[model samples]
Target: MSKEAQFSTDKFRLDGKVAIITGGASGLGFNYTKAMLISGAKVVIASYDEKGWDETSKFAKSVNGEVKFIKIDVTAKEAPDIIVNAALSKFQKIDILVNNAGMQRRNNSVPI
Candidate 1:
């Protein structure tokens, strides 16, 4: 065999990485945030819900992960710049982006 290593064990390791996760405060987005944080990446959670920040922050603390929260409606026009700036200011760089922001509404339908 050649002297090159075939596979290293750090596939999911995100040491020294920075991640921006849109809608990362709740639902499936929150799950992604937790995973990345646990993987050694500093995460910036861009969420519309201000309350979510508190909860997410607490969780980050529990796991001893670095996390920042920015309140922005991802659907708004200025949202992109806001999120990018937040991440840069906090972590200095962004290596991963989990663009998982989304919304859902349930409306009752009337029979025609």
Candidate 2:
């Protein structure tokens, strides 16, 4: 069989799998989204940034894969539930979840 056929076997195929990726609008998260799509996984990328959200949505469309963007602040108490619901509403099931949302600010000195 051909390479594509080999990869399409049950073990390698993610045809019915659903993946939720946070911070997926750009950088490392974007790459993860693309990889999951190429592997046949439906992906939902959540982000609070509007510009990044729009750009990511456009890119996802070009790939012809099932992708969606849900505006959310990861730090919020209800954000996780909201994201989970959105993914389920779109794809019906969630097979994988990539929690890549968070921010880190630099602190030059420590105060005692």
Q: What TM-score would each prediction reach against the true structure?
A: 0.79, 0.76
Q: What is the C-alpha RMSD of each candidate to the true structure, in Å?
A: 8.7, 5.5
Expressed as tens digits, the lDDT of each residue in 44-103 for candidate 1 is 988778767877888788868999888778888999999998889888999999999876
| Deviation (Å) of 17 in candidate 1 | 0.7
**Which digits, one per residue and each the tens of the lDDT, describe model 2 over residues 1-112?**
6543223334565677899989887878877777777677888888887557666667667756788889889778999899999998998889998988778769655478
Model 1, total clashes: 0
Q: Candidate 2: list runs displaced more than 4 Å.
A: 1-12, 106-112
| lDDT accuracy of residue 3 in candidate 2 | 47
- Runs off by more than 4 Å, candidate 1: 1-10, 105-112
In model 2, how large is the Cα lDDT of residue 86? 94
Cα deviation of 15, candidate 2, in Å: 1.4
